[model samples]
Target: MSRRGLLRTLGTGAATTLAAACGVPAAYVAPSDRSRSDLSATDKRLTWANWPLYIDTDDEDESRRPTLDAFEKRTGIEVTYTEEINDNDEFFGKVSPSLMNHQETGRDLMVISDWMCARFVRLGWVQEMDRSRQPNVTRYLDPQLRSPAFDPGRGYTVPWQSGITGIAYNRRTVGREIRHVSDLWADDLKGRVTLLSGLDEAFALLMQGNGVDITKWTADDFHTVCEQVEKLVRTDHIRRFTGNDYIKDLSSGDVLACQAYSGDVIQLQADDPDIEFVVPEEGAELWSESLMIPNLARHKANAETLVDYYYEPSVAAELAAWVNYVCPVPAAQDILASAKDEETAALAEDPLIFPDTAMRKRLAIARDITAKERTEFAKRWNAIAGL
Candidate 1:
């Protein structure tokens, strides 16, 4: 789904402030104690919390979700799904009490942006999956997505969908190709460039433009990006920092180029072909809104089965066609190519969704800002972005 809420973004939109809502818990959870009493063996049901408009629906019946229904029918497992996530912080606030208290969230499986997933993983508020039960995920999950710095080997999380943070521009207004991040600062784009207001969504791409290794970026790397942003703010080179509102600015040609999400630009191009998204020559960040089995869930086995079921190439392709984010299962591209509808088949080749080899080489997943780093970083970034 294209999240339109001011705070709703592709990943954890609250990088700096997420931890402030709760002073970092002094207690840590041992791995042996994270699992709750399992009910999957006896109960044929599980609950899933996710964002709205995220799954493939039947064309004539919005009530029916095709892949989800298929999974229920195939496994005799009933999934009671709810679209309860509107804002990342709001959802975190809702669930943190239970996760912090070591109680069940009453949800078996839930999806949250990977940036937030890092917090859950770090605090040991989520349980690791037994990979032997997720063979499809093992076989089809994209290798590029396998080892994010926050969750090495993905022992505790699986990506639900993926996206790229890159540059977007209106070719007609800019009157030149924007091949690198530096182009956003060109004299032609002065006072006509925008950036994402959220700290997490904005920093990695900016750091990448400076040739920093995002996966192992340091305190110095972060401050260097902040210093440049502070200068740009002083010079009026940046018109504003916004959320998805950048879409409106780009569409109106008020801004020639700005940092943008791949999926948002694809939708923009359908209406205005002049809009373009670039994974800069330096690189871009590939991030996900991922799924995690929260602390103590009764349906761990069923949730694991459901997670792996979505990893099946055919199931993943159906979802890719609907939501139009980067698909985490690379093999799904082939399934999309053979889709019955020609347009759907062509989507299989969209470099934004299934980026080709050349583009893949320029993408990296930056390590998430830690709880220790959040306070200082958020203070600096929010001050500069004016959020």
Candidate 2:
């Protein structure tokens, strides 16, 4: 499924299950019990679970992933890569039973959104990584993403890819530049705008529009945006709420402007020059789908090695050239700029992929909605979104 299609399926039922899992005391694993004897020295293999189409793939042969193939050849650690994670809540439902019962999840490493990573950190479902084994991550990981509120100093998670939740518009169709989140509400855009429907995906950018520091926004800040959205929906100003389908709306000129992911807009711009993505003046949310090691992962040391290897600028550049999200390794910009292929070198200049200094100033990582806030907030946001 497309990333947006997977995200669109995140319904209330899955969210309810996530909220319920938070309160069960047995679900919390103590630090002392989080690791098993490392078999990495002899096992020579590891498994990884991630979302579909998230990594660099050979253009002619989709089954062959270049960077991953190189990793196995260099390190002799055969990787069992599965694109099994479609939705955060759904994946949590699949794995939570074993994690809470103190059993191996049969996977060594997995990538999930940082918001969900926060939940795992709180519940102690993942093991802390040994950074001594990951020096490249220690040096090259982007400074902006280094210290998220949920995993301060990042003891448990390493960002796989980072992106912005910002405004996207068809410059020709909209007939103006969208410089702020509030720009979507202009009279000319009435009935031509769409917002994301999922609560976790939608709220941070809206909160940023109100000039709230999303890193520490309050309940009132959330409700204030809710009220505004309700008004827009009531008046038919918003054409509809959307998932990844917003890409289609913007591309077809059916919708002039909407909330969109930075990475998706990159693909859109490749096909339609008029499509533009903006990190609004008020600010935009910087989020990541991160890699984490689950408790009892037998190949813990090998998994950590794989994580660090990607942090190398050359390998990171190869992956960044294909995926085109914001590269978490800033040094990779230089690598891309010097590539033999001009088209590959041009990726170095795409601000959406490697944000310029000015754009970097306007990005902030939003504090995730807490377990205590999840149930109530999802109920309200889902109602307004008509989910």
Candidate 3:
């Protein structure tokens, strides 16, 4: 099936309502009669689920992650880390059956994007974290990410790493400056740009252009923005909607500009220095791929320890340097600043990594679509895409 079809299929009111009830409708699991592991005492093992290529692995031997290995050696807490998450919805579909049934998901902790995390928080599929055990998180996490609309005060979700949804353009090909979201729809750029296909990825900047405060956006505001997007579509102002494939289009000069994630833009920049990414004048969405403990995990305590371990400045810096995404721990910026390699040291100044105050104001955390809204909007969006 096309990506649009798949998204519409999973984004139904029933699925969203179910998701709101179970914390992750896509990964909903029926409760298993089988008993959970009794690790209330000295449970030494933890099962962590995350996306592929998220963690640093041995350069030659991919089997090992140095930081995780260190944690095991120092604390004797064995981690069963699995990169089972690919697409958010795909992974959700894989695990939803277990969540709905109130059963053990066979994994302890998982990482998912913040927008989806909101749904999980709403459904109560994840457990509230013990803040006492995560003192480093309290100290080092960026103030901006601490109290998102999804989990106020971050009682349940802890951002693993954050990134920006911004504009990326090929300087060598475009031969013009593109500084704002409005610039994307200029006449000359008509067929040379792409927007993110997913609603969560594309909505914030579009809404920001209208000067709406995203944190408190109303349904009328959403529809108003949709009407504007529909106009853009009718005018052929938008070239196409895309997944990560926008990277390829930009590289080939098929697309001169497009909506892009900061992490992916960094990779493109490394390959072709002429590729430039900007967090547009209207502002961009600052998002995270976060960590949460599942409802019936046997190793919740061990999982908490692992989560805290990553929040340490040094550990966060190491991960941030490798992932090339925004680090949630601001203290890590200092650590990166002192790096021996000039390349790594210069990362400390990258606004996308540690957004300065000016950039921070431009960034907003847009609310995730409510269950009814998801069904309503998804239908409209899918119809436009001919899904």
Candidate 4:
């Protein structure tokens, strides 16, 4: 069954039973439990770097996040949260030198897209978490995110929230229902479709269109899709490759269909009722931006505490409502379902936020490209993108 169908059939029930047995080890323990703390007074304050507009912000002020403030008040740990990360590759380039040298990133806990997190773990630039202090994580992380190809046991990272890379189209402009990946290549979409320029964002769905399993996809599978996209590009079937600017284009009717992230589509839907998102029948990539401790963080314990604090169902619910992304804590879905406001309550039923079992099955975390593969893949993708 398609991932969406799985969700319609299983709903919240599957997450209840499947979450525990996901990627986490039954007898697993974090290395932090055995390590000694070397933190000092200055380390009392930990720096946390995250993507822009990722967390819950005060509705009007935008400067305050009630949940984060409460965490600091209760724990007495100062958190310097900065929305400095604008793009994954840009952030990685900025911190690459420090990470390669094992120097402090000046960030105790940083949130990065999982694919990049895999690079950090592979480079040994992040710390392994202590599971003893993170019982909430061990018990509460959504089953789907438990064991990704990059971090099988998920010892190096934990998801902040998850989302889908799927198709987004303005229904009024397109005047048709787009229900599958093959629809993007239809003649009707010629010169009216945009795909993401970022290789990570664009590749998986294309692979799925060819009916390849992403979890264990091969290099040949990648090149095969690349050649197909090259053919489309040469024929001018694609409008252009883009960044987040695709949102602007879609909103303005300059583009009718494009690849999009689920979180961004939620924002678009608020103003334009015609904007629609769909998880293609062939499957879409289920990706996450995760939190991890940098190699030389001074407050690993405090960071661990903060990570666990967010796992509580109540905390997770508040965040899920604010960010409008897939919640990693299944228990939080029940919380939203009972919200007092109809608007908020409706979010609980949104399949994008808490995908039912069928949707969960269609969702797969694609393997990260190796550095060698990246060079070759980027060359091909950039050529098609006219970069």
Candidate 5:
């Protein structure tokens, strides 16, 4: 199953509802209380929570994650890794109580979508990582991903893997090339194109389609896209709203073109060469599911060490090979290029994995929907998409 297939359909509604009931001020943690005294000097272990199938797992024995095993071996820090995160809002609901109370979540590290990271950063529910200790990250992190609107300079989050939100189409089935977001609206694609259902997942690319600057898109810009999408839905121009199931539709030829993630397209192309993913001429949303250290994490220093270790070009290349997402470390491209395995070396040249200069020019990380905007935006979006 694709990673997104496991995501909950509710999006951020659950968390937003909880915040409304409890009141935002009551849940906010003061900055001084966000940290706890470090135990990393003596505690040689840390627990990490992440999404399923995210890390590099051994083919023969799925229990063994090569990169993680190497981290344990190289630095005597034993990691207790759990694939416990299934959805962004679901996971947020799971841990928000502890975070709101300023208590340890019993997790040293975790990964979630950057949009959710913005929520935690705003609530002061996560600790800022010390970059001085993360030399590889400081040197190799992609410049394009360095300063998202929520976490300027990436002070609180590190991208675990990145992907592009763009258009994916079966070229032969479509019988034409799709160069812009406008192409999906062509009369030929009526009742054949699908869109993402989740409010956070669907909005930016649609706004980008209208030539809006997603990084600083205004409320008027958001409502304009909503109006357009509502019209598409009413006229059956869109077959339906979808989650990751768009992959199934496209693969089965039910849909010819749809909004898709870059990583999923890579896997699809391996099976059917006709599958093509495009960063539209107007632009596409560059997004990431990022790593973060929650407030009062007991092994903060040990977790920081692990984060830096993965930033090393060689290590990043190995992880990138298996995960097939955009590598946050661009330096890893050279490492993959020099690998002995032919298939592995070819990955170094995949623009989806390491985007080319021209492609990079069109990629932008959208500004996160704020606490003030999420409820209103999600309500309008959910009503239209029927989520």
Candidate 6:
């Protein structure tokens, strides 16, 4: 349910196959051809596709989503929410044809990792949102996330939820603190440390540890990390590369340290205080799975309304409490801090939820890996990870 770590396991093999099928065309959609009819005046409904257990569901009813319900009451717009996006690559294969051929993808709006959003943006497969209509989004969205390399000016995408990729370890078992990414390779941790298996998942932190600027990391910087990891793999210094399975290892005390996600580590700490997540002194990646309105969506304005509604601090705080990812609306931190319950109030201060200024200064949104970089980089990375 930690959709934060859900990006990498979307299966590179499936994405590669999809890439072949979706050969980029010479033609592209023009600005004039992007907009469809303004159906918001007549159609009171729109369909949304998202990952499972992503939204906050009613504890008692299990079927109702309170934040979404409130949106309907406020605007009279009905949403047909579907949890159909289990994997990014698989979902791309399903919808790419429709998008590329200028057909309706049967989804008015959707969410996908920022790395993949780069592809859609480059392809002109999605429509730009009207900034004038999204006052809440324009006001409350994190400034750090406003102009990612893919969506400059953020005219196309809005973060659905945000999270950090950093180091997590069982401090009690490790018997020392891990303050830097280099600490994972310390002699005492040999054959007991795990890195993520996916190339996109694993690279940024390693690169950051070496002082490479992830916002504009060069190919030489990438190769430097690869060389170091390859040496570790050969010496058996790394126990193995893994996905979210690292959670079980850290919880069971089978592995003392591993690459981890902030959101997942927060949940783990509730049950096991020994598990600690850290943003290494060097840096960490600030990532978001964003909301994008796909091309030719009939209910474009309606979808924009829903997107902006979530940005209101009170609504964002409600969602953040349930989903437990880093809230995109930093204003929500104050809202959660003033909660009536002590437990809810503590979340406001949790560095993992609302990262402090120090942590914020160290985090960077990595530039999207390009189409040309994908094939060769993945080939080498997968070989080293033995995936």
Reference-based lDDT, each prediction: 0.89, 0.91, 0.79, 0.81, 0.91, 0.88
Clashing pairs in 6: none
- Total clashes in model 4, counting residue pairs 3 or more apart in sequence or in different chains: 10
Worst 10 residues of 5 by lDDT: 6-15
Candidate 5 — what's its lDDT?
A: 0.91
For model 6, residues 100-177, the per-residue Cα lDDT tens digits are 788888889999888888888888888999878899999999998999998998899999998899999998989989
Off by over 4 Å in 1: 4-20, 24-26
In candidate 2, position 63 carries an lDDT of 97
Error of 6 at 149 (Å): 1.1
TM-score for predicted model 3 compared with the true structure: 0.89
lDDT by residue for model 5 (141-167), tens? 999999998999999999999999999
**Would you estimate the TM-scores of all the predictions?**
0.95, 0.96, 0.89, 0.88, 0.96, 0.95
- Candidate 3's residue-wise lDDT over 142-209, tens digit each? 89889987788999899998889989998777788888778888888887778877777887777877
Better of 1 and 2 by lDDT: 2
Off by over 4 Å in 3: 1-40
Q: Kindly list the per-residue Cα lDDT of model 4 for residues 161-237, writing each as its tens digit.
A: 89999999999989999988889888988998999876888999999989999988999999998888888888888
List the lowest-lDDT window of 10 residues for candidate 4. Answer: 20-29
TM-score for candidate 5, residues paired by index: 0.96
lDDT of 2 by residue, 132-169 (tens): 99999999999999999999999999999999999999
Error of 1 at 282 (Å): 0.4
Q: Pairing residues by index, what is the TM-score of model 6?
A: 0.95
Reference-based lDDT, residue 67, model 6: 93
Clashes of each: 0, 0, 18, 10, 0, 0
Error of 5 at 124 (Å): 0.4
Q: Scored by Cα lDDT, where does model 4 land?
A: 0.81
RMSD of each: 2.2, 2.0, 4.7, 9.5, 2.1, 1.9
lDDT at position 199, candidate 4 = 81
